[model samples]
Target: MDKELTSSIEKVRSAVKEELTHYLAEQRDYLTSIASELIPVCDALEDYLLEGGKRLRPLFAYAGFMAAGATPTRTDIRAMASLELLQACALIHDDLMDGSDTRRGKPAIHRHFESLHRQGSMSGVPEQFGAAAAVLLGDLALVWSDHMLHNAGLSHESLMAALRIHDEMRIELMAGQYLDVREAGEKEFSVERSLRIARYKSGKYTIERPLHLGAVIASPAQSEHGQLLNVLSAYGLPLGEAFQLRDDLLGIFGDPTVTGKPAGDDLREGKRTVLMAMTLEKASAPARRELQRDLGNPTLTVQRIEELRTIITETGAVAEVEKLIEGLATESKIAAQSSAIAADAQPFLLALADSAIRRSH
Candidate 1:
């Protein structure tokens, strides 16, 4: 990573944390007597938001603003920080849906609530209570994301422009997630479908939309807005796909300590990622049957995971995915270099693309 880009990302991280702290504190005071029980919900939200994350959305947003030749202000930072809340909502709901036990190496929100219910001897079913709480918490986070963005002091026109991208991003994310969950249970695999899932679920929301939001903010009235958006898409779309591909690799093979999730979690969840789809397409009959049997089995042992890993490797899926990532990465770099984005911002954008695909976690 470029030292300058790294420093800029760190600065965005710090700014987001500060903005989140202030917002949560205000909410805490506002809800103090209205419903004291909700206090813990806020606490959980804070912990989840502040605990551990790369804050990639906001950094990308900032880069987008810079790419559009706009200097950032505190209000811009606050508005950009809202992306983290949106992400929190997505993760909370995703964990609940997946029945995941942990996130960031800690008990997921629903599991945390389940433990609380059990510890307190609460009347209802702990599992149901946990699921319900997680759903509501996730909704709250989504709402708060809107609130933060609305209150960030952008002109009404700017807010509205940004909201268009924001709304589309959310819609695409939900639609993509639905497809992902639906495809997981199907026996057949399709590379095309998997790529579509990646494009919507992580790609656009993770990079393209953020960059567009910033570009809109900076040049809502500029004649070249369309061109800038196209340029950003040129870079963001491919990089986003590469990002998800890297994540697919990490879900299976990454160190738990570094990834903050259990090894082979994706296999347990039967994630229908491109890597899995491609592997399925090429594997021998026996290997395919074994994979189908154990892919989503919750009780897969460590030895079984190792066997699956060997199968994936032997089938040449890993190499193929790596080759794809490299190609997409190169494509993104070319787009970034050739785009009419501000020269001063090109290096940061390129650095971000490199970091996104090359990261271990």
Candidate 2:
């Protein structure tokens, strides 16, 4: 990353972190006041929210606001920071749904609750208790996202505008997630379907919607900013897809230490990503048979993972995905250069394009 871009990103991260700290602290107090039993929930939520994350959604929103030629206030930042809570909701539920044991190298929300249940020697199934807790906590996070945004002190007009975008984003996120879960169960592998899943499940909310959120918040008059919004969509949509593609690559090939997940975890989970679809398309019949047999086997050994990795490489899927990422990123940058973008925000969007795709984890 360029030094200037890096600094700018760090500044946004810091500001959002501060806002989260303040917001979570208030919620913690509220929870503890209600009942001592709720203390555990508060603690878990604090840890999950405050721990490591890229804060990419909020950053994109801030960039969008900047691109709209407005300087954000603390209230604006708080509104943007609400997206993190929404993400927390998504990730916690996702972990439970995927049966993931860990996130960011720590026990996932469900597993964390499961351990608490076991430690307490609670009756009934610990796994069931954990699943229940994870679901409730995810719901709480979703609720809090709405509360935080509503109380963030935006003008009534801006609040209404932001709400519209927020609602649409959440709807798209759920639709995308459903598509992904549905696809995972099906045996067929379709590149086009995988790409669609990426766009809805992770792409739109991850980048495009955030940008739209910020842009709308900056200039609440939707009609006046239609052109700018269109331009931003043009920039954001492809970049968002590229970002997910990079994430797909990271899931398969990233180092455990950096990615905070087991290597080839996506393979074990049978994520029907574009890369996997392409590999299945191009692989020899024998190789395809091997992959089909082993792709979702949770007990896969390291040696078998290496074998699958080799097969994916031999099919040239990795190279193809990389090309796709580059092309999408280029499209994003080209859109950023449009006259619709504010002069100062153009560089941020350009640097962000690089930041989005040029990552190992």
| Cα lDDT of model 1 by residue, 185-249, tens digit | 77788899999989997779899999888877777764434788888888999999999999999
Please give, for residues 174-228, the per-residue lDDT of candidate 2 as tens digits.
9999999899988799999999998886668899899999999999987634898
lDDT of all predictions: 0.89, 0.92
What TM-score would each prediction reach against the true structure? Answer: 0.97, 0.98
Candidate 1 Cα misplacement greater than 4 A, ranges: 223-225
Model 1, 97: alpha-carbon shift in Å? 0.7
Model 1: residue 164 alpha-carbon error in angstroms:
1.3
Give Cα distance to truth, residue 164, candidate 2, Å. Answer: 0.5
